[model samples]
Target: MDISKYNFYVGTSRGTLLFNSDKPNNIQSAKSEEISEVTSLNFGRNENELLIGYDNGCVNIFDIIERKYIKTPELQGEGRVVGIGYVNKSIVIGKHDGIINVWNGKRNNYFDTHLDEKGTLDTLVCNENRHGVIGTGGEFNDLKLWDIETQQCIFKAKSLGHDMLNLPIPTSVRGITFFPEDNYLSVCATKEGHVLLYDDRAQRRPVVKFLEKKASYTTIACAYRERQCLAGTTRGYMQVMDMKAGKCLRTFTNFTGSITSIVCDPLEPYVITTCLDRHLRIHNLETKELLHKVYMKQNLTKVLVKSIVKDEPVEDTSEKEKVDEEYEEIFENMETVVSSKKLKKQKRHDEDVTDKPRRKKKKKLKQAEG
Candidate 1:
């Protein structure tokens, strides 16, 4: 599936603009000014409207077919809007002040609000089944799953305490995504470079955690029909993880800067990632090969690859083979008895030599006595 037909809307500190990816990397300037540093963006499910959430607490909707900005009267607001998602005909805007505003597409009215007055909204996501989940990236550091219709928090996963490991301190949950068919939630952070898998039906602790030391995970997407998850890190690395086994399946390190966003091709398992290196890259899931790369003048913070094909698989390696290779590496790194015994013997030898009497000490003591 080719993404050449798709146009890109990028939000920057200066303003927001539309760029045709098929063009010569030149942005078609939109009329909006000072777009509040777009922190998150989402297109409507039917591709009718494009939603842009900004740092200055404004959510703007644009008409894609008509190529005009829809002047939604009630949708205008002033808060640090951090995340945006579309569910059915509803547009969800998550703000830095911890309020989730739901907007109706037909009427263009503010329908509901899910407010957590204590925390900040870090990420907002909606699955194929229309289940909406919000990750709060503040001192609370928890994931809240809500019923969009009722605006009630159905489930909550609190953050694990600090001092738990030698890993970096977690800033806030940068992103959260649910498995396509399962009850699993993939949680990523801005500080700790790890993807945590938590089962909603189970207790609070994560069932599996995939930790990497390179950089923080800024965004993640699940494969089209598999249990694998694709993640983008701040260091410009893209990795696929099998949530079932809690291991990284494949890794691609081609981007020159931090990866800000990632999304799976709607039709296939191919993954698309945007980086601060000012490039958009498409990778085939099966082969872990980069299919396309488009350089841009703007540092892309988010990317979405809307697919026209429905149910085709991208060519890549098998999941089982990848898992086995990861397992082999884990076993190879296991400490051996011989190494443990040698370390103990060395410690004992150093203690014995230190405990022996020193002629210099005796001479100093005699001098003091005299």
Candidate 2:
């Protein structure tokens, strides 16, 4: 597969850019003075329009075919626009003040609000079936699902708790994703350092929880097409988990700083992670191999890969490739074994401490001896 044809849209702290992922590394200036800091981005279904949400309460629409900035009346909000997603012809923008605004291309009065609280919109996800789900961070640590057609919140799940006196508000729910080919939802955040899978059709609590070291999870991506999920941790590690078994299958540790964004190639099923260390890495999920690495000058906040062709041929593997696959599988399984052992040891230590009897010194025994 020609990797160069894949175009990447990167949302940075300074602004956003379109870069050619192929050999020459061509960077195109997509947005100019329109945005000061890009907080989120979404590409239209047609791939012609690029929507960028800024930290200064502004969203810009760029025409990719025309190669010019298309003017949409600026979205007005009280806080920074943190998340953006596109479904059909409508644009969903989530703000830091816990407000979701749906903008249709036709009218100026086309704005529908879904959330009204004090929280940062961390991620906006549109499922393969075009279902809209929004994950909130900071003050409100919960995930809320919305029905786009009716513009109503259908379900809300609270996953994290906080102390009202010291911390006051809930910690951030950094990432949320829908499982592949199922109604399961995966949520990850800081403080607890665990990935939670919740069955939307059943109970309120999580169905399974996969714990990690004390690293804040910044981003997560579900390979709904590939039946796997990838999580990017604050400690610069990428954990690939099996969605069905709720297990951490592999860990990639090439990054030096916190991982800010993670995504899967829609067509290739390869994982791409961007980190504050200024490196973007492409990993093959099946073999756990690092395919490509690109070094950037700036701290990459978000990295998204756009598959040019919808119907690409799958690569056929030979006997030699199968041998390599076996080796990769062993490496991945070994990591899981080590992690499980560590968790077991930690649990045993906790049990030992809790089971220890308190020491009591009796004054009556001393008096009798005297």
Candidate 3:
């Protein structure tokens, strides 16, 4: 696997882990700033900066190159920072107690929207195309989208009213994501193994629903292909669901434990996931193959990836290698021909090859005696 093109940072159970794909073994832990468990994290305004959200309700920025904290921003909320997303020039923070705060690193507070303190806000994500748009969801609460600039709820999911037994279906949303291609299209995964896709421009309810029976999907992300999504379950498996066909396409297995977060490359065909099993792994979405993995001491909660998109075409040498290998078998059993071409040229001077030099010496001696 060519891991040189990717760059990312992992937020562990204790602190942040500075990771490099080029040298996966050369890892550095950031234990400064007196911060506790890094609950959530995302990239700041640029690739050189990273935004960190701690369990103690503290938010700070760190320089990736300097390997130090730039500044810490005091939060007005009072809960574990469960989720974070950077949009526009500010960051949208979601606390465990269901408080959504948008801060621009200034003194004044932008807006503090409440999302049902009864349930824990487990997931939050921002759209890649829109700056002000962000999505949030949690236990017992359906998904909702907010516009930070306007400070209004632009969209709220309609609950799946009741089950066959007449009990209200629980909406324990564990993961949420926005599509990179179409910002209006979004998806979320729930504890009940239900993955729902919502098109805000179409309706308030889920336009499509996929069920991964008997598995608790912990995190969700966009897949390698369009009209498809990837999700990680508590059963130690990652599912690739075709949102367009409404069925699971493939299941990636071999995870040690429940996955904490899943990140898919937008421009590449690779996916990375953080697991409670204390390992960071990258997988190929097309082949469902494990490309690379690195072990860490703590459970990984979040990962911020840096993708370098290129326009050049990649050459495939698989067919060429196969052909060369087939031709090699013909010569492997053959005898060693040491002088195939070199001895053929010597055949032309066979008669006078060595005697011509002796004959010239004899003529010189005769001329000197005469």
Candidate 4:
């Protein structure tokens, strides 16, 4: 639909493609240094810089304005980076070994710590309204909010027991995001195919737990202005969940594999999703319509939906029309001129043949009579 306010960048196994949401087929590709698969991506506060983490445990910073790689920060862990967030002048990275590393531009050895050794960090996000609040969760990690200033976890989701089956439900979070308008509120996708909403002010329990899909949910994204969210499953199904009602409003089933990432457009009624099927699809949030789809050759693991670049040039329809008109006029003139020249040459050849025949006949008749 109307995606003039945002640019979409998809991270695939081979490389990344930067393009407009309106024209996803037309793309500008950028690859990682070693061509490693991009595992996570996050943009800075101003949206001027992008941070990319690869499967090889290497991170690269890119200047969006220049559309070039700026630098690669030294990461301590030797595993895939699953999550990335921004805080003031530094960035926080969540690795597969459950290690959270913070790095600024100046130093290599800045802030590093492990949350857990058993499970990987599957989701990471920051509260833009609250500077120090950061959320991280994964398998057996539950959901925890960290205070970046104090470097401590402020809130954590508790475990719950099953009722009739006596089965234990471990809080394995697949994705996390804070409501853009409220820093106190955050949401996460669970391994049980449900969405959980948390309030920092009331940490007693989750305010609501909405079941989105039948399969495990691998990613979740909060809408720009509404209390609605988008959730993707391991089965490639996408669901639109309403946090206020704690129910699923709609479902989209077109992906052939697990959904890797989801992002909502801030200014438009659209959502972008990247799937392990090597395809990216943009959908209309309100109308429940498929807007644009692109088939990437590589398996996509993540995507960074960037803000719009201001003052972009609009399409010049007038120039295209003028060129088309000039081409048609030149073609018509050339066709008429060629036809006229052929006719004139034919007439001259016919006259010459007639006159030559007459002259030959007269000479032969005179010879006969003499």
Best candidate according to TM-score: 3
* CA-lDDT, candidates in order: 0.66, 0.68, 0.81, 0.78
lDDT of 1 by residue, 301-334 (tens): 7655443335677756688789889999999999
TM-score of each: 0.71, 0.73, 0.80, 0.77
Q: Is candidate 2 or candidate 4 better by lDDT?
A: 4
lDDT of 2 by residue, 1-370 (tens): 4567577777777775656634535566565675467767777656777887777878887776677766566665567777777865677777766566777876432333444455455566665453555444444546666776666666676554445565643445777676656655645544456677766678666666666757668878786454477888878788888756778787888789988888886657588778888777788877878888777677778776776656877676787799999999989888444588898999999887776642223555566789
Regions more than 4 Å wrong, model 2:
21-24, 108-119, 130-138, 159-171, 183-191, 224-227, 267-269, 310-370
Candidate 1's C-alpha runs over 4 A off are 1-13, 21-31, 74-78, 105-118, 130-139, 162-171, 183-186, 309-370
The digit string of per-residue lDDT tens for model 3 on 1-370 reads: 6776777788887766657645757677776564478877888888788888888888788888888886556666677887777776777887777677777777435455565657667777777777788888888778988887787889999998888999988879988887777879989999998999999989987999887769898888887688788889888999999888779988889898998888887767788998999998998888888899888878888887886567987667998888888889878977877685766666656767778899999999999999
Off by over 4 Å in 4: 2-5, 15-24, 108-117, 307-370
After the best TM-score superposition of candidate 4, give how far the Cα of residue 173 lies from its true spot, in angstroms.
Answer: 0.6
lDDT of 4 at 55: 79
Q: Which parts of model 3 are misplaced by more than 4 Å?
A: 110-112, 308-370
Instruction: Give per-model CA RMSD.
Output: 26.4, 27.6, 11.4, 13.8
TM-score of 4: 0.77
Error of 1 at 94 (Å): 0.8
